[model samples]
Target chain A: MIEVAGGRLIAELTVRRPSFTLDVSLEVAAGELVAVLGPNGSGKSTLLGALAGLLRPDTGRIELDGRVLTDTTAGVHVPAHRRRVSLLAQQALLFPHLSVAANVAFGPRCAGVGRAAANEQARGWLAEVDALELARRRPGQLSGGQAQRVALARALAGEPELLLLDEPLASLDIDVAPAMRSLLRRVLRGDRGGGDRGGNAVGARTALLVTHHLLDAVVLANRVVVLAEGRVVEDGPAREVLTRPRSPFAARIAGLNLIPGTGCAEGLRTHDGTLVSGLLDAGVSGLLDAGESDSWDGAPAVAVFAPSAVSVFRQRPDGSPRNVFAVRLAALEPHAEVVRLRVSAPPGGPDWLDGLAADISPAAVADLGIGDALGDVLWFAVKATEVLAHPSVH
Target chain B: MVGVGLPVVLWAPAVLGFALVALPVVGLVLRADLVRLPELMTSEEALTALKLSLFTAAVSTLLTALLGGPLAAVLARSRSAAVRLARPVVLLPLVLPPVVGGLALLYTLGRTGPGGRLLELWFGVTVPFTTAAVVLAQTFVSMPFLVVSLEGALRTAGERYERVAATLGAAPATVFRRVTLPLVLPGLGSGLVLAFARSLGEFGATVAFAGSLEGTTRTLPLLVYQQREVDTDGAIALSLVLVVVAVVVVAVARPRVAEGAQ
Candidate 1:
């Protein structure tokens, strides 16, 4: 098995260029796809560059399967070509002069396969991408999606142990994204799942998919690692992380309300004292209990939930969930299928109301006619299980 | 009327300037007697000079490419101190007058010169007054043209493609052979043509270093100069032949450069 086994990708890599410093530590196991999600200048690309051996990490170690790719301590450093890691940048930089077949054959040829053998292998890869018909065509003659597919084939042909994708679909037009995503999912599955021709070694390929698109991560990656200001704010299973984000950044990506708060057995309390009662999820309950002790360092924390999770009624609905709170409709904003209502919870009751934002559907707003009111107390009930506690505000 | 006249007036001088520069070549072709061409081809000295010119130019072009191609690649790829120093030194020969280049070669390879002394001491051989000296002089003058052209091509071709090649598992040498060489071929081809043409017409260096020895050091240009001292018509005929060869070389090499640019 290609086990990563607790190896730390620790880097205090400070490239101070009169603007910013990028410092982060990350770890991943073999057979896992970690999606590095962030906005621009969030050190997502910088971190990938450092990991890929393109940029030298100013300090720290990058290990893969216990093999040191870069370690400043031991003076072990491998160049980019020898790293056996494949990178698919946003550009899909296929060589312009070479034919599609020749471009795919490049890696195999470099690996010491004879020209004819390399070409044969390239044809197989092209057929896998369904682009064997375009093998003789130049990169300039292909569409953006076609070029990206060829690039993916070229990278996979090397049979790299570690694959890094930097927003591989970012440059494509929206109409082609779904098709590209489907193709990418198939490739990812083929590489990871041990049920097909691509499945040989247990964890032969570990992937890090860098993307700003949340849906792409949700669909393709096994786990999502949220990066903000050059540090990982949250990392977990994709569904869990996306639905119940632990950071404001993740909350923004997942379109949920993320507030910094503390918790007790009764519920979570915002720093401004808006008490959210009845957190019954054991995982969340344990976090609440942990926060109630003297040993509890009042470290910065986050409370997150989806907009749909918080039900808004015109008046107090009888037998509603215990975590109900009275809130004034602060602002209304129209999102895709829903109108996100900014509910202002009363201050000093529990600090859970601090910087709290919630999304309510257009149907809920129409049903209640809760429009442009400043001080109307709208009853809002959230299920206890939906209230998630994460350790940082992000 | 004045506005229309102004642009036409402004462009007239440039048009005339181009015509002035092209006049000599047009004059050469126009003045040549088509009937005398067949008789000129039959002359023994003319044929010997043409053959010797072709031979020396081919040898010179081959040597230039062999030596300059690697030198250009090194200058293109390396950031070492020696390479930094050697690049400008390579261009020094290119900028020097052909006669000055000839004098420099003469000083280094003349009978009593340092290289000549070594040759005599080691192998009991001398290169001056020989066809080999003519080839050597022509190569010395023309090699810088190939190096400079190929160097520019290499620089523009960039290291990204080579790095990609390497990552694909190509050893450094294979990347050079497959990717780097083919990309620079157009520039290399044009450089070879220019070097060949320059060698064919090389007179100053050959005369200074190899001396005016008939059938040996007498390249086409040297033969033309020698014939001019006695028979001016023979000189004109040889000049016509050189011009035709140069035109054909330019005709072939220009399209290659244009295609590469595209």
Candidate 2:
């Protein structure tokens, strides 16, 4: 049962809603914080609800640390309160009527701890979250950030075995989110708080953080699991998944232009048979060189490049870049100091390669005189050296 | 902001509406004999009615809160068709004539009624024309106020905080006691006040169900009605007393602000 030192969760479930269905299989090792990244309505919160026992999946099994929380076939189910899982939502949602100290003590009090001991434990958790000074304040009196801090203390006061964070920083001010993020990172890693509590060994508790923000995944999660269309499309270490995303949603979050195709000797060939010539990423090259039995001739692969690497021209240039395509301007958006042009394949060109973003300097947009040329055929070029082609996971 | 400006013609009807409510009280005050006001108000019948009104109103308010609170909670959360259908029935007393409400209760618990017959056969209990009947009548008529106020409060306050509490290891009952109850306290406060005011002013229901027995069942409104036949001066003084009590209840509760605050 103790496959690893920490609590390990294995969930494979299908939840059907009116307009959408979520089917996902996921695993998170004990003490590991895995960020679930997806767009809205992509089943991110549904996954959290299933894990916290607030939702009952249509059919599946969810086992955490060898204890089955839900099993449709076995007719086993655990209610949310007894599941020993806590959730910190976008809003602080602190009990407005209770003092901050009492709010934090509420979990312990509900668990049948005596008043004095619960208060003492609450203070300890509050200090761990650096919110001890707010003990006497009511939830309504605190700022958004302070309230979130107290909410975190209250969530931890119960010593939950699993902590589900549903975009805890989403409601915070932009300027205050970074500080909270660092605090979350520290506490989730077990750098603070008493480590000797039951089911909460001397390290971080198992956590599944649902977020759409890439920064949250990069900063606080050990691994990133990307969801698209209610399925796990990408799951790997945070850095690897963010850098070489196979799903369009993941690529968008990572701020990269991704072209999906099949790998060949020269480069990747799109479904329309247009060869996007590029150099294989070092990881893919290493995998091929390791002498795996399967050949890479027609395996699924993706070519990714920074949007800044794309060069746009009104007319075909003389050099003829290896990755040049006849494209049409889709939309122009202001991205910081540059104007990002969203280009797509021209009328006669392959339609699969669409919505490719090219970020160019504002001066370049003026020099090229293409600022108002929406839907006009243009040339988008990227050097083979700039593109990193890797094997697609799905 | 432009269209929100009040038109000149609108103020006339609005002022007339205000005057309609204010003029009656002014007439009552003008007709009262100020020198004998204290004497008329302190009569034995008036004092008994006032005491009975306060006691019955207090007890009925407690009973309504105990039963209506859970009813409101269930109404707010339940999606079943039965609950949806029952919602209007729960609110029927609000729109139904108070006399009709009293008749419904009497028929349901009267000596010849099914529940009354069962109570008599099992425990030999008679529920009409007693002080307890006054309380029962008050609770029946006043329940809709508390239920409506609390249901709106529960809906406005939402289940998010309760869901959060459940995840934080609070059982369903604890979540209700600690989080749900406190979140809607302002709603509960105004509901209880409205119920108390309704109970205090109860007349028609008590007349039909409890029969205006002085000291035992006759409340303030019933006493004022009884006095109006033989002692018009005492009735007017007691009517003023009822008006004062209602005003105090409203002032203490601050219904508009407290109910809308959530």
What would the per-residue lDDT of candidate 2 be over residues B1-262, giving only the tens digit for each residue?
A: 4686878999999999999999999999999888899999999888988999999999999999999999999999998999999999999988899999889878988998888899889999989899999999999999999999899989999989988899989999999988889888888988999999999998888889889887999888988888888988899999999989988998998955454674
Q: Indicate the residue-level lDDT of B26 in model 2.
A: 97
> What tens-digit string does per-residue lDDT give for candidate 1 at A275-345?
65544445544654777543223545566677778877777877845567767667788878877777665
- The top-ranked prediction according to DockQ is 2
Error of 1 at B184 (Å): 2.6
Q: Let me know the TM-score candidate 2 reaches against the reference structure.
A: 0.92
Index of the highest-lDDT prediction: 2
Q: How far off is each candidate at the interface, as Cα RMSD in Å? A: 2.2, 0.7
Docking class of 2: medium
Chain A TM-score relative to the true structure, per candidate? 0.78, 0.91
lDDT of 2 at B71: 96
Name the lDDT value of residue A263 in candidate 1: 50
lDDT of 2: 0.87
DockQ of 2: 0.78
